[model samples]
Target: MIRSILLTAATGLLLSACAQPPLRGTGDLGVVIERASGSVQIIESDSHTALARLEGLGDLSHASVVYSRDQRYAYVFGRDGGLSKIDLLSQRIDRRVIQGGNSIGGAISQDGKLIAVSNYVPGGVKVFDARTLRQVADIPATPLADGSKRSRVVGLVDAPGQRFVFSLFDTGEIWSADFSQGASPKITRFNNIGQQPYDALITPDGRYYMAGLFGEDGMAQLDLWHPERGVKRVLGDYGRGQEKLPVYKMPHLEGWAVADNQAFVPAVGRHQVLVMDARTWRQTAAIAVAGQPVFVTSRPDGRQVWVNFAYPDNDRVQVIDTETHAVVADLRPGPAVLHMEFTARGDQLWLSLRDGDQVQVWDPYSLKPVSTLPAAAPSGIFFSSRAQKTGY
Candidate 1:
């Protein structure tokens, strides 16, 4: 009887000595970029609370994030060419490296094993092992005709295969680095895609990769499934007759454009959002907005599309009914609305007000404020749901 009792007590003590099991999953967790401070506020979507603050991420003035396939980790790309791997459950930066001089954005491979960053100063795409932040391949941008220097890279995104596609801004060309084979990828070059391809995005299905043209009125689209068809220009004249304003890449391109059968794209320097037929790549309609639109994002449900403008009109937001192709709600939020993110299923719409120093959530249907979370010069709000998304 004494030995049995001792054994029971010893087992209980050993069990208590072990670490506790994880209490929360990472699915509802995310991070908000604190641009000025070079830190991020780890937030929870359900409770609408900030759980942790991770600092020393480097220059995040133009920072962007992508997620691992499981959504447990976030990869942040900063303007100072710093790439950080953050673990949500641990609330810490797992790995970090200064991979470039100036990085605009980054994307994770389809398999979630690689991370690619598009740089401006060094002017190329750097690929690293997602977990270790170790360089695997270095693909340089095409050199200018005069060979003065390499062109700047933009619109870096991962496709269906284990490939990284990006555009060269100075040279107006698109290159595909197929990494599926191994560290040395097969490179395919599409020269003269446009005058200057500013930014790009891949369709949800990963079939079409479209790069926005800042030097022209149209965009360049490549059918990834059939790259042999070459790059085709779509909506070539949609912005020709509008009051054009020079289109620039937002600090954080959080606005998602493709929704179901239609693509809601922001017209280059116009107070309008152009609706295009996703199948034929033709303009169906151009809905006039409050000002020159900066971020044109659609809810996950594909039922509503919300827009935030640039400069003086940046405070106002408008929602469009995709079915009716009409502006439904006009909301006046805080100043300098930098970016917008929808909850995994569109239950809530979150926005970062840089000038307001706040993060606001709203009901996508009623267009009313749900909750307000204070932030420090917040620029981007990303949710873990992005882990399961393509071209995030």
Candidate 2:
């Protein structure tokens, strides 16, 4: 009896030790931000299903997520300046910190050791240690020339050589902080880049950075390869002839809008998507669209560009043929279409229909819905693939 009891207990302990969640990889996983609930739902791209919902993330009114280099963690930047590092494997927030009063967006460094956030409340950029959520560096937005008020920082992105670049909306300037030497970053500022620079994007190759000016028609370009060349004004005459219309919501220059040696962007205060030649930084053509464009996204193959519009026409999504610069397809997903994201391989397209309380998956080529998943006021759909991209 004693021998039998020993064997049974040994087997019980062995079973207990082996009792754990099934192992899985994170490459196929992603997250959807539920803005109303202040939570994010972990999802699987292959199955098109919601695996888990992790909550308690604060103030997601304008939340954006960037993944860790290993794709194991997601760094979420919230409007209330809450930085939450979520572990994808365990499906929980591993560490979180309130780093600022107001933050717009953030980026992870090329080496993935640092996370930089752009703020508006205190108007500065804060660098934090990725693992522990510890603040490593604080670079305040350069105060205006008079030294009265700090400028609100926008368009923050991680460039090559462990550097972070951003634009100052209040000061019309762009600054680059190089952190390769040590904790203290060497700062480089370019003033008068443009009036009211709203947002910016870096090219796929990390060679050029473009800032879209809201106070004026043109955009300011900074060639990362040659800092001495300074900012070159492009599309300077874009909005000259037409009467500028009221902007319902500021457009985003976030997505990788470059395709086939051409860069595509949303025209401010107009119903068009501007096409520019990547080589010369000159406006090639402006394709008229359904309404004021919000997010202009290109597929992984760079064959087509998909655009979503602002308020009154928020329900519509228009597809542009990159080769011909023409509207090929116009789709109305639903009311309150907040954001759009494509799978890593560009096999499927996902859109957050806030009014419909669902995330709709579709065939980008056919413009047909594949499936709809329920969500509570979803805003942004981000994939782990962005972890490897330069200007994600």
Candidate 3:
């Protein structure tokens, strides 16, 4: 009896300790997940170490991660259609939500109230309650050009009026859905925005949503409020065919960032990040990079841009000075720089190196690698603020 009582007391004490709020600023690093390795590492600002490494939730190499607005939780989605809720404070997976069907990508609302994931095979977007990570609604697949197959929601953006905008790679269209209610949500066909719309980012003010058109002239900009306003071509051709070519054979625009009244687009074929003014929608500058860059993200402070390339030999992360519009540094992290993300505070950068089977951390300002974290087939990563400790 005495031993059992003591053991119970010991366990209670440990649980109490785990329940306390984690060291602040540690969570400031936000969230990062490596798709191939099925590993997610969270680092706080400038911390020489990682706060927590949540592992084995699912196959991360093909998953997409997003942080809740409160920065407390991370929602992970696998390409096979598995969703897991991770507790940021405890550094453990809380539960798994089976989103029946294959997923291409997913996103969390800025308000942290909802999460929506694309089901490619079935052609639909599943919306869930941010708190419970429970399915609230399933928006059906929006139509596309005939014979194009239901375009997968490769990229999604939450907008006003409980509406979410998703991009389709197959048909080059953007669809809008409403998830105001917990069930029976409404979906609408917004417009055919561009060709091969892979990713999108909304302006800070929510005035416009810009979709990166891969293998096209440039970014296709749409009025978030009025999707029927047709579309405007923002950045110029990325030099796909000679100096300038017809729209059909344009090289392509893959990754993009909207900041400081300019949209920074990474033209993979051109090996350049074309900058365009948001208001005037004119070409401002073209920043050259090392290899076929895949992603262009803003520095934590939003003052600089970071470009990452793909495998089998993209061992470096390129840093571009947004102010000067110049390539500043190339950070050699390791093998295969597949996908990467930055913590909320922007103090640390997380990289998914496919060949290395590791997720690397870097100092955004100094361009120095801070640590190497374990991950499997590291792929998609996103930050979440609404995570919480769910008693398992």
Candidate 4:
């Protein structure tokens, strides 16, 4: 009897250990801010429920959310330059890093060691330590000698060999940096890529980096290792003016969906996701989507791509098949569906609805609504690594 009881206890302990949750991520907390008051609301992704509502943030207009590598903490930036650090699991605001600047965009490094945010008003970028949430480096974005407007660093992507790439708005250039060994990240100005290469993404294998074009109807690609020879145009002029109406606009190449060496890029003005062969950087085909597709994200398996947008009518999200490149299902979560993200498991999708004051959850495969998580003005939806601990 004693031996049997001991074995039973050991088995119970093992089962309990397996049931324990995982760690948090830097970019996992789903944030919704009250547009009028800047009230911050956080939802712990594991529960699909409200974790906390923080008040008195004071009108954080259009804040950006990026979680840590582990998803334990979230770094938020407001338009007026308010930066708040939130503990995802504990459901509390850890600290406000700084205040005052035109903080527009932010990105966590690939290794999750460094984070950089754009300061449009004061002019430059602020680099923070991802682990401790400390200000480590500040790179001043001085205007070029030609008397051009001061360029704002809008988007950032980290590549292999510990290198980082950032997009410059004024000069329309992609800047490269190495933060692995340098004291301050070294910025090497690469050749210009099109008129305005707004945002960029590194391939999964870290071979090439592609930048989204803002001024025209195409994108630019660069060899990650070379960097200096500069970028080549990948997609442009989809016979739009001649064949159909102009479908793309400036700075809207926002969504990137990658599946099996193929990059699905949404040329928003064109209302289609252009499938490109990542190996050759050639256009395979374009998938038709409904009105003004704002963001394109996918599940872990890369089988389905989710596109969210406002317009031809109300805001909605559509799921597309990666293999077929066709619209599989349409999910109308709410109005102003700005961004969507999938859990690490690829089971559930979270939607950040701006107008409805809630974040909606859906089965990415079935396209069925599971739950509606309330928030004031949810701009972006993310799943922290910690929030995925409950096996979500």
Candidate 5:
């Protein structure tokens, strides 16, 4: 009788232990893009360790990912027009579809109901149901008056009111499509924004959309709040009277940093970052940088702007103080530093070094290396926190 009672009590204790919820790991999860192998390394920002590696993603050379609203799904936009919906918790691809022949990147709707892809082959934006990956709407980049061929679309982003905005590389136009009404989206196109809008970014507040022009000296801005006022070209003639250097690679506008009402934008072919007043839309100052700047991203806390370069200087990264407008720290993580991502609270920074095949984490305030995780030709490091923001 004593033995049976002891066994029953032990079984009851085991069941009680199992009934309690499993201890949750740190919620700071993210993914690092392995461009060469077409895979992504799931990592925890706090632990600085890779939890899993998901493979078989096609042509991730220029891949980008946006997370679902609940932070459970990752919508990966592949260079080959493949839209893959990944389950972050399960570390598996939930659903995927070939949306187009060639694609650049994509965005998720504000409400997490839709996903939009910018295409290079068909020259248009295709919207898909975020849950089912079903085709919802297709808006073509129609030809402008100067040409009969459709233009390639790039710089796609989600806005506040269930709208997706993008720029046309060939037509020099910016467009916004409203999907609040469902399958048939209402479209608005602004013309003559600039020449060769290589990339674009929407401000965090979702009020302004800025496109970096490669063929011209400045950028194009659209006030989303007042679209009838049309697109305004700002920072024009920035490189006037100076022989601009040949651009080896187009600087990405997605890296443009905005902090404390100032915008730090990469000067196309110059080894400098252009500072502009976000309110006035005027050039405030130019900070000389190490090399041709590609991404000038502001830290989450708005205290510093981190800048990365292209090609020859791609191995280095520089941080600028927002208050002083000065280059603070110049860091060399490794060769071919492709991207940088800060933790949601701005405590740490994760940088991907393609040539080194590793991701380095550092203290954002002290500029000290904290940890490193091995990866394979990593490019973009995206955090799950991005699921809550307008544009990631």
Candidate 6:
């Protein structure tokens, strides 16, 4: 009878142990790319703490990450053409595949069904199944008349209605591939868009697509709602008749900000952000900034615009007031401020200081440091909130 009682008590203890609740996870989470180590630090945005560090990613020197629709998986694109699907919940790379010799970046389809990667080595865009990472389509960049099939692809982005749009750096053309049907994608090519379309970006509403030209003075714009109008060149002759300074780094079009029917664009080889009226597509104002601006990103709430510089001025960041179009704050965050990411609600801004070897969180309103997380050569800070947006 005593033995039976002891067995019953042991079984009861085992049952109690099994009934213990699992650790709860915070929903506001992000990932910091450790470029040199080829790893990422999973951080909780609300608590501003590192939860886990994942490694084994290859050649992340120029890495970019996009999250799955559910924000449970991160699709990391490596410089060496490695695509890794990391399960953020488990902090492990669930699937990986070498897609090419060199890849620039990637995007996820609107419906969360496909993943597209832009390449440079072979010069084309490859689309894969988002769930399985299986190659579905190989849209090779159109060759020039001189029989060169090696036009480097850049500024690849996913548009609404299952379409992928990108530009050819060498060919000066933009192509949109519609994948609504199946693995075979229908292509729509726009020729002679401009000279050296360095990078491109689509508006948040997915209505307009713009490409920044490196070999010319202005940029090219296209209306996705009406592609029949062809590509229109705007911001005309912004660099005409001037002995321009040699560009140390190409300005990123992804940093362009759209708020209140106006767009803030970083001028190439100039220390200014061109404000254009979205309704008329004309330059409204030129907001002077410190040094050459590389990224002019807007706050999530569209209340302010944040500008970061290149090279000599990379250590400084400036915030611009959207209403007054003036520089409100000039902050020297740290050395080598490579990237900045805002929280989902825009309450906090996270910065990656590559030279400082740390990631700093700051209150966007006060522009004051909230916390610092130790890192190793951090460059890009990506938040899971980007999962719902296109062209993150």
Counting clashing residue pairs in each candidate, in order, gives 1, 0, 26, 19, 0, 0
Which 10 consecutive positions of candidate 5 have the poorest summed lDDT? 237-246
lDDT of 6 by residue, 1-392 (tens): 99999999999998987765334543587789999999999899988999899999999998999988878889999999999998777777889999999999999988898999999978899999999999988988877678756899998998988898999989999999999898798899999998888788998888888887777777788899999999999878543224266667777778888999998888777888889998887999999999788888789888899999998999999999998999999999989998888898899999999999999999999889999999999988999999988788
Residue 23, candidate 4: Cα error in Å is 11
Screening candidate 1 with a backbone cut-off below 3 angstroms (N, C-alpha, C), the clashing residue pairs are 245-269
TM-score of each: 0.93, 0.94, 0.79, 0.81, 0.91, 0.92
Top candidate (lDDT): 2
Question: Which candidate achieves the best TM-score against the true structure?
Answer: 2
Model 2 CA lDDT for position 331: 90
**Per-residue accuracy of model 2 over 1-392 as CA lDDT, tens digit each:** 99999999999988976764447789998999999889999988889999899999999999999999889899999999999999888888999999989999999999999999999978999999999989999998978778877899999999998999999999999999999998899999999887889888898889888888877777888999999899988877543233378788878888538888898878777898888888887888989999988898888898889999898999999999999988999898998888989998899999998888899998987889999899999999999999998877
lDDT of 5: 0.88
lDDT of 5 by residue, 1-392 (tens): 99999999999999998866344632588889999999998898877899889998899999999998888788999999999998777778889899899999999999999999999988999999999999989999977567666799999999998899999999899999999897899999998888888888899899999887767677788999999999987888543224377676677777888888898888878898998898998988999999988888788879999989998999899999989988989998889988888898999998999999999999998999999889999999999999988877
Q: Give Cα-based local distance difference scores for all models.
A: 0.87, 0.89, 0.67, 0.67, 0.88, 0.88
RMSD of every candidate to native, in Å, equals 2.9, 2.3, 5.3, 7.2, 3.9, 3.2
Candidate 3 regions with alpha-carbon error over 4 angstroms: 1-26, 51-55, 143-149, 236-255, 311-313, 374-377, 380-392
Positional deviation of residue 76's Cα in model 1 after best superposition, in angstroms: 0.4
* Candidate 4 minimal-lDDT segment of 10 residues: 383-392
Task: Give the Cα-based TM-score of candidate 5 against the true structure.
Answer: 0.91
What lDDT is reached at residue 290 by model 2?
A: 95
| Model 5 regions more than 4 Å off | 1-26, 144-149, 238-243
